[model samples]
Each structure stands twice: as structure tokens, then as C-alpha cells.
Target chain A: MIVSLTHLDTPAALIDVPRMQRNIQRMQQRMDNLGVRLRPHIKTSKCLPTVRAQIDAGAQGVTVSTLKEAEHCFAAGIRDIFYAVAMAPGKLPQALALLREGCQLSILTDSLAGAQAIVDFGQQHDTNFDVWVEIDCDGHRSGLKEDDKALVQIARLLTRGGSSLCGVMTHAGSSYELDNQPALQALAEQERRVCVSAAQRIREAGLVCPQVSIGSTPTALSAQNLDGVTEVRAGVYVFFDLVMHNVGVCRRDELALSVLTTIIGHQPDKGWIITDAGWMAMSRDRGTQRQHRDYGYGQVCTEHGDWLEDLRFGAANQEHGIITLQNPASLDIVVRFPVGSRLRILPNHACATGAQFPHYHACEATGEVHIWSRLHGW
Target chain B: MIVSLTHLDTPAALIDVPRMQRNIQRMQQRMDNLGVRLRPHIKTSKCLPTVRAQIDAGAQGVTVSTLKEAEHCFAAGIRDIFYAVAMAPGKLPQALALLREGCQLSILTDSLAGAQAIVDFGQQHDTNFDVWVEIDCDGHRSGLKEDDKALVQIARLLTRGGSSLCGVMTHAGSSYELDNQPALQALAEQERRVCVSAAQRIREAGLVCPQVSIGSTPTALSAQNLDGVTEVRAGVYVFFDLVMHNVGVCRRDELALSVLTTIIGHQPDKGWIITDAGWMAMSRDRGTQRQHRDYGYGQVCTEHGDWLEDLRFGAANQEHGIITLQNPASLDIVVRFPVGSRLRILPNHACATGAQFPHYHACEATGEVHIWSRLHGW
Candidate 1:
């Protein structure tokens, strides 16, 4: 049964549940056939219910970017956790605490100093922690060169310090820069070669190098080969946003999350329709910068997730959004949407926009409604 | 005593607490002399401790953009709240609950339909609510023009519906568009005249306009005239950001919050330094779009908050940031910032960036530290 529409306070965030579920199932089924473990990145949905759904979808573990996410997931019975960002000495204490709480925690490090700091923390705590030396495959974010001597030196130092080395992990972050499938495939090969070579070098040094993690939603999904990779950490796959569509990672229909907003006012003379949603509600994520299309701020939607033709959020302030109608003279549809009419907005980056709101108002494809609470903060 | 610098997280959010205290005090003292109530907006900090500090600085009430923010402030002992966005019928039931819980909650609405919806919701819930008709002083966001018939109709409907008419409020969001102090002052007068005219029109229609609220940090701070404004609601004043400095609202010395990040790598050949902090860490707040000077992503700083010369964040990705040195050839001052060196980054828009992280590492202007947790979502 359809729930009666409640007047959502202006600037409230809305999530289409059925779309999210479909997106989740699509990824899970793909990974199931791939024969590698799927560790969905929790940073995408900070919501507990979404994570629970991922676990139910056969995800082997969850990857997070912050300690608070690790703590929240662990408290919610998620045991296998990988803190994907490089670890620091300040966070080691918290990581040790989580490990002692019977949680399997693995951290990434790209620098010798970072490795030394982790070793010092491990020594002081009298604990042997799992360490993953991050390798820079595409020169995207942070990672060591695949052939850098410092990688071996840091790994050897960790091993000498009684820390268990968990092999190497790298993210082909630059894959998002590719404009087509061929470039995507090239990035995938780069990812595989760097990760596989890093693993080989560590093993050649006579050490156990079993786990080699490599991921990026675009690279992971488009990769032609995953010969030596043991696990993939892909987030944003479950709720592909406008950025994904622009980068050739997914299509508009594949995007799951959207901001449900209401038309609050209209400037008929200017052909501007204002919504209750603004940067404060929709987040300031301009994910279209690297894409072929600029969906000015975000793509506007009709009630059922269809892109509203020619409508764009041309500009926004904290609580104000101005939509410019592509053709102000269009006679088929009303240019001035009356007050209280609801509209859905597709975000530029689902992760950043999703992080703004507290709960997800999940709705099935058939429009069945449920509430999902999201965890926030560190 | 200086705290020992160890391996803290690479990209962590830090706030200068002493400067924050001074910021609160200065705004509070200004409002006190103006003989108007200070309903400081919490959208900037979103932190309970920061809100408490505002209260301690003699703020009369709090203003928020979302119900989640109102709920957070209410739970923290803030009784008087103004939900400063246009309210909808679906969200009214929840607002009524706050009223039932003994909190003095007020909401803004700009249309007759919006007012009717709230009235219907109030009837359905059997609760009374305070309503304010939002007025448009300068075509910035959603609001009824002072001379528009819609304003009169909305006020009549709200007064006739058993809901308490708390008068009108307007935000001069365009004040941020001004490039000089004179333009800011002109915008302030325009805001004052528009709001006062709206209040007069309401009173002329045989209605009591009890509170006329008008605010924008620039207008509020530079306004030589606030003849009819009963209260001022400006949030970003407490933590002046780069946007404030760009608009001539405040100087850089007045900015109290910044992102604490670490230099993680260096591309000596490209004259680019990489930091763990990126768009995800500092948020995508490009507040200088309309300003005379575009400060790239944000202003760079040393650990003690001193502005660094010529170093600016040239490009950023979701998890990576590239800083370009002003002079590509200068290598005199130790060309490489050690991998573990910590740096502070000034924000573009304080409200948007502050919402990205969970808590603030509250540090004193003198460099002492504490932690303040932030609340999110409704």
C-alpha cells in the first residue's frame, strides 16, 4: 500500500529504495560470478540498513575510510573490516582497540614514515597488526611506486617488527579520468599489473603475500582480467551517481539514490523554478566537472525518476536553488510548478550528498516506503 | 606546554577554539548594542559544543536550516528555534512534536499553499505552531515579494488558521555577491527596506507583526539601519570563512575554523605537493566564484595558522589534492614538506566544509586542543 505523502520539511533528503536494491543486486550478482570476494565500501551508504543489505547480498566484508565508520559497523555486527585509507599513529590506538574487540582490522600505508609510525604503535601496544602496503598504480591519490625500494623496506620493517604483512592494495583512481571503455580497460590492466607485481616482489623476498586488494568502481567493473587479485573494494557501485554516468561507469537508469524535494516558489518572468533543496540539502558535489555532460549541480527529476527535460539547477545558495527551464516558452508543461509539488534530484556524488542527511527514505520500485538510518561522524 | 607532534591522521578537521570563542563574543556584543535578539544560525558549526558556546556568548535563540538541526539544538537545551526554511505539510507533524515537547518552534513559509498545508497538519496533529511568512527583499531565494498580493494572502491564511503569526523574515543571500563594503551596505539597506515594508503591509491589513527578522552576515554586520528588524539570524558570522573575506564581510584574521591536514607526498618535478586532504576532506565549497579573487580551493596555512605564501590547492579529486607553489623554482625553504608534516587549510564555505566530518579537533589560537562532536541529518 502506498503511504500517504507527508509534507517533507523543505530541504529534506529522500532515497528511492527499490532503485537502491536493484543497483545492489546487480553488483552482487556480477561479483558472485567473478569468483572473488566483494567487500563493498561502506562510505557510499553510511546507513546501517544499506550495509545490512550488502551483507545479505554476500559481501565478504566492508571497507571504510574513517575510524568512526569502522566502529559503527563493528557495533552493528560487521566483523571483517578494512580501513581503506592510510593509517596514522593517532588512529593506531583506536585500530588496536577495535582489533582487541575481536574485529579483523586491516589498514593501508604508502610511506616509510607511515609504516614506521604503525610499527611504533604496534610495539607500544604489544600487538601484531595486519599491514597492507599501498602501491600507486595510476598516480591518482596516495600510494608507493610498484617498484619503489621503500615499499620492500617498509614491508620488511613491519615484518621485523612482528606485524603481519597482508600484501598490497592500490586504487586506480585515475580510471575516472578515462572517457571510454578502452581507456577503462587500460586502467584495469595497469591496476592488475601494479598489484600483481607488488605481490610478486613481496613473495620473492621470502614472505607470505597472500592478500592483494585492488579496486575502483570503474576499473573493477570493467576489468577484463583479475588474475592475481584476491578481493575488490568498490563503493558507489550500489548507488551510482551522476559522476559515474559521466565517467562511463554507469548509465542514468543505474543511479539509485535521489534527493526528493518540493517546488517552493517560482519566478515566472525569469523562467526560474525554486526548490526547497539547495547546497545544504543536496551537498556541494560538482561531480560533473570531469564528465562529458555538466548536469549543473544535479539532474532534476519528475516524481518517478524520469529526468525532467531541460530543467537544471543553474545556481544555489545554502537554502535556495534556482532552476533554469531549458525552453521557457514550452507550452506542453507548466513552467511554474505550483507550491508543494514534489521533485526528485539526482546528485553529482551520491556519497557526499548522502552524507548530509540523517536517514534514507527507502521506497521500492512499486513505491513501498521504509526508513533507513545512516551513521555519521568520526 | 606544546602538545607533542606525533603521527596524527593525515586529513583531520581542526577548529581554533579560542578564536571561536572570540568570534561568538564579538557577534554577541554587536547584537547586544543593537538592542535586537541574536538568533544565531547553527548551520555553520552543526556542533553541540559550538552551539553551547554561542549560548554562553549571550545568544537569545538559535536558527537552523533543517529539522534535524532543530532537533539537535533542542536536545542540547536550546528551547527557542526558528527552522529558517519554507516548511511543508508533510514535515509539519514532526515540527508539532517539537512544540508538544515544550520547545518553542517557529517555521517559515512563503506561499498561501505552504501556509494552508501547515494549518492542515496542525489541525491533524491537534497542535498549535508559530509561523513566519518568508519575504523576498532582493531576488536571492524563495520568498514573497514585499509588494506581492501573495504575501498578504499567506499572512491572512496563517492568522485565520489558529497558527500564531510570528511576522516575517528575509535573508539577503545576494549580499555575498557584493565585491566592496559600499555594495554590502547598499544590500543591507535594500534588505531592511524590503523587510520593513513587508511588516508594514501586514500591519496595515489588520494583523500584528510581532517579529520581523532579517539577516545575512554581511548586511547584519555592516547595516547602519535595522529600524524594523526585531531579531537577526546570521550563522556564518561565528566562523568567518574565505567567502566572508572575499565579500568584505570580515578579514582572514576573523576566520576561526580550518581543516588540519598532513602533507603526504611531493611531485618535485611538477612543483606540486600532494596532501591526504582533498575535496572529500575539505569539501567542494568554491565560495569565490563571484569574488574579484578566486582563491582556488582554499588558502594554505602553517600548523600555527599563519598564512603561507603563494601555495594554493590548484586541483582536487575526491580523495586527492594537488598544491601548486606560487613560484615553481623556489627551493630555498626546504622544497619538501616531510611526509608527516601537518598543515592547516582555510575553508571556502565554513558551513558546507564543516558538515563533511563528524567532529572538530578543537584547538586554541595558542595551539591547545580538545574535541567537539557534530550532529547530522534529520
Candidate 2:
């Protein structure tokens, strides 16, 4: 019980501090070499200490997914916060309050209507806002096409309506699907090109688009250069998971986040070792299922962080995980993983898995554990 | 400014209180007709008001998934709480604390080693626990086989060790895979028979196996008769989801839980309307993917609670949901779902999606809303 994770409750989120620092250093150094500020997305951890570590590692201000997150980061003294998702008109008051409080906040939008609402609300509140237009480099989830005519229209709307145009940003989230370096690097370049091109189009309309931001954990690490980009905003790199591991960006050993679980029961005949960590702990993010290597629910590891390649986390209930052998030959699973034995599971998505916990058990290299509270709920 | 769901923040969990009460009434009446106690599993809502509604509707005890949930329910004056997962030795101390504090907490185990540990811990603490043996009915997740030889061994171990063997319980979690009424009814009967058989096996060994508990949302709702069962425990039935709907247990209109989101941006070319609610709000539970009808992520509905059958929630990032048309045709999505317009997304799995929020905006029949806080994390 001397500060080790062994005594903590099962299905607890464990953050290997050394691995986390190393991952952060690696991402920050890469961005530095590429001459771009790393505005680390705090949406991944939602933990102030982790975000502080990123800041200490030469990363710039944080990027948030929700205005609630923006408020939390700002309260933590992080002034340069960027709300990366398109601003919904209903949340304008929340953003206005954050900006009025002296937080250097930037909101995003990809549509003319969204931009108009933001500009209109800012004017109504008599507070000018720094707004970034979202661009879609990859045909993924959100954002407008890089070459869309709406790019200049939105930029003109923001700048003309007394809001500061803070350039363009895009996340090639599709990079998570690629496992090859060449393809990832190409996507990263495409992300950079698309974002810079959007900024170029905005600037051509006589509006000054100052910064061009682009990233995703895979793209940021695989990018050859940031010739036109000014800053990179990447989450998940702070706590790489099996999804990133499958994407060929980080090693399994570098996955800083894992769910510490205990063997509770077993179905020996079925070659199964039932664990207390479930999809609720690892999240329902079967991110690697479509990747090169599908880590069923998660990659199973020993209590000391050693991977158990022979076993796979195949199924999970709300609070029970099913760990079975890949080959299913007799290995005396009951004896090998008896009741009360501890194991760690590398998650499919760090953000999704981390959200399942209220706080993380930060395990230092010295085996000393500390509880770092997380900001949950919007 | 009215107390309506439309005024709440986007990506909020909404519970139709009237529908919830109706669902509760329906389940309670079904259990009454079947001659069994209704030990409502509180794992789905984890909300005090919701649980109180269940108790108000004649639910005898509450079933929880974690000790944290037990603590919450106990603090809220719920005494008969059952932690249904196979007990881990590591959690014995936490369970002991709850028991010592006068929580009528019933713990579970299916393994001999687990039973031994629980008995030993109870003895060491100078306290006796009411323990229930878990029986595997449908080979779903966790539990011992109904006829496993270990059943007698575990029962004898607990009874002789001074711990009270309360009963045997089983959950036909695999019933979720069946979409037809006949298969679900068959599985329900099997679930009841297996659990009753396990108790009989223990009783034949001259032990008093006083209770037989069995359920799952689908099984409990579809069970023709629970002849030998003392009580039935079902969680998701309180807020039926699309998974339950596809499982032929509940209808889409009966789904009491939903995520209220606001349209933020659009990819009109791709027939996408990006909403603020994503996997973070809805959870990544694709429970209906392999069911009879695959709801991509969720079924999109109008803010007024009318289902938009043409639209499907296809993909999601952390906070971005991509709502696309099932048949990719131009419906002028941007105009139809204009920015700032509200939308409701019916989740695939109620338990998984409900866990994503801190509280629910419970809307009553009068369009009035109240905040019902939830229990989060262990």
C-alpha cells in the first residue's frame, strides 16, 4: 500500500507519469523542430496537472472541446484557450463570459450562419472575439472543405463584424485510420496544405488570417514539415493508446494510459479470465478494430506494464471484461491469472477511456501514486 | 427562459419523466403478475430521483454495479443494495465497510476462491455477509454454470463459514442479441430455470438456498413466467434504448433517455449535419450494430420528439456527431437543420449512454424540466 497502484480500486485509470512526460516531450520537440507552437488539446486528459505538464514541456495554450472545458482551463490560469469545435449560437453567452473574464479564448466556426451568430452575439455583448474558421482537409466528421467558397465568406463575416480573424484550423482525424508512415505523412501534409490554403483564401479576401493550425496525434508525429502552419493542436499524444500504437505513431510501451483491473472470476473451459475492467473503463471506443491490428477492447498487460501478447481482451460488459487466449490452448488460466491478480489494459482511445474516471492514479517511475482530479461533464 | 429542455445546454442527457414512470409502471406490473419482487438495478440511471421513482412504484431493493453506487444509494436511504458483479477480494474491505454501516448489501461470487475469500474476510472482520452465488444461464458474460459441480462446494463453503447464502442469481445478458419475441421468451425461461436449478443444487446438498433471482431488460420483459424466481432485477427497462427496441422488448417511443444536441455546422455535400452531441454524450455503445436493425450510432429525432427516420447518426468524434441521411439524397440539410436548431438523439444502449452525463434534464409531461444528478465513477 506504499503508494503503488496495487491497492487502488479496480478499473482505475492509471497514468504512467514517466511515459506521459516522455510522450509530451516527444510531441513538443517534434512541433518545435517543425517551427510550430504545440497548443496541446486538453480535451484528452481534462486534468489540470497533465495540461500543466504539457505547458511546462514548451507547449502553448490549450485547446478545448467544450466551453465548459474552456472555463475550467481558464480557471486553472490557462488564458490562451481555443474552443476547437464549431460554436453553437446557444453557447455564445458562455464564451462571452469566459472572454470577458480576460481569458485569451478563440472560438471556431465553419458555416456562414454560425459565424454570423458568433459575430452578432459578440457585437451585442460589445466584446470582440478571436474566431477561427474550421476547414476540412479530410472528408472525416466536421468542418468545411478547404477550398469551399464559404471559407472567405465566413472570414469576411467575422472580420467585418469587428471579430478578430484568428486564421484557420483543421484536424485530419482520418489519420487515425492509417497505419503506414507514408500515408500518415501524406495526410499530415494534406492537413497542413488544406489549413494553410484555407488561411490563404481568407487572407486573399482582404481579411488577415494570422495563424494556421493543424494536427491529430498521428499527423502531428508523421508530418514532414509545417511550412505554412503556425501551431499544432494535438490531443491523445499526451497519453497514447493502442489506437495510436496501431496507427504506427507510438510504441505500445509508450502508451501512458491504462485501466488497472483485477481478475475477479473465470470460465476456464472457455479459456477466459474475467476482469473488473469493462467498456465502461476502457470506453466503447473500438478504435483499433478498423486499424491494422484490432485490439479487441484493449491490449492486455501485466500489473507491471508488460504486454501479454498471447491474451486478448475480447469482450466486456458494463463492469466485467472478458480476457481470453488468442490460440485457446490449455495454459491453466485460473492458476496463471487467479482471483485478485492485477492487470492493466491499454485503451483504444485515451480521451474516451480517461473520461470514464473521476480522477487518475498517476503512477510515477518510483511507483509512487498520486490522485489527480479530472474535469468531467460539460 | 422557461424550464424546458430546449433552454438547457447542448449535449445534455434528457429523461422523459412521464415515459420513465410509464416504463417503471409497466415493469412493476409485469413483475407483480409474475409473483416476484422487483429489485430494480440502479446501474442504468444511478440517479436518486429515478431510483426513488422505482421505489415509489414498489421496487423492493436496488441493484448496483459498483461500491460507489452502493454508497450513494445507501446514503440516499436505500438499504437492500446488491453489488451483482462477481466479487473481487480486493473490494472486500469496501464491501465490509458498507455492510458494517448497516447497508443490507448483498455481494456476489461464482468462484470457489472468491467464496473462500469473502467468507474469510467476513470472519476476520467479525461480521457475516449475505452472499449470493452467481449462475451463468446463457453463457453471456460472467457467472458459474447452473449445474457446475463447484456450485455445491461454494455453497457449503459460505454456509459453513458463518456467512448467509442468500440465493442464486443469473442475468441472461445474451438475450440482447435476440430480436424476436419467441427467442427472448425462450431465453427468459432458460434464465429462470437455470437460476432456480442452481439454488436447487445447493439445497439438495442440505443448504437453505432461500432465493432465486434472474433478469435482463429483454428477459424480464419477455419472460412468460418466473415460476421459481423470488425476484427479478432489470436496469435498462427504466429507460429503454434502441438496443432494447431492436431486441423486441421495447419500442422506440418507449425509449425514455435521449441526448439533446444542437446543430453546429454542416457538410451539405456529404449530406452531413454536425451536431454538438457525439460519442462523449451518447457513448460509443454500438449495441444495435449487429441487432436486427442497425442504428449506426443513434436514431435522430426532432427537438419536438418526433423521429426523423431518414436521418441516421453515422459517425462521431469526441464532441462532434455526424448525422447523415440513410439514402444519400439532397434534402437541403443545412436548411432543414439550421444552425442553433435543437435535435434529440435516441441512444442505442441506455446504460452506456446514461453514464456519459453528470445529470439528466428530466422533462415532465408539462414540458417542464428538472435536474436529476447522477452517480459517476467508482
Best by TM-score: 2
Off by over 4 Å in 2: A1-3, A327-329, B1-3, B327-330
Candidate 1, A1-378: lDDT as tens digits: 234335444455566666677777877777667777888998888888888888898889999977788999999899889998777556678999999999999887877777888888888889989889888898656677878888788889989988899889988988767769988998888898989999899889887888889888989888887888898888998898888887887877788888888776676656777777888777887778657888887999886678987898888877668888877776422334766777888898888888777777776666566767786655
User: How accurately is candidate 2 docked according to DockQ?
Assistant: 0.84
Residue A29 Cα positional deviation in candidate 2, in Å, after optimal superposition? 1.2
lDDT (Cα, tens digit) per residue for candidate 1, span B1-378: 234224445466777777788888888888888888899999888898888999888888899987878888888888999999788566776787788888899998887778888888877777777999899898877788899998888888877887899989999988888868788888889988899899999999998889889998888888886788899989898888998988887777888878877665655546666776777777788888658878777888987689987798877765567887877687732245665576788988898888877777777655466667776555
For candidate 2, the docking band is high
Show where candidate 1 strays beyond 4 Å: A1-18, A28-35, A201-208, A329-336, A365-368, B1-12, B32-35, B55-58, B72-79, B119-129, B160-164, B204-207, B263-276, B315-336, B364-371
Native-to-model Cα distance after best TM-score fit, residue B65 in candidate 1, in Å? 1.7
- Give the best candidate by DockQ: 2
State the DockQ of every prediction: 0.43, 0.84
lDDT value, candidate 1, whole model? 0.81
Clashing pairs in model 2, backbone N/Cα/C closer than 3 A: none
TM-score of each: 0.90, 0.98
Question: Considering summed lDDT, which 10 consecutive residues are worst modelled in model 1 chain B?
Answer: B1-10
Worst 10 residues of 1 chain A by lDDT: A1-10
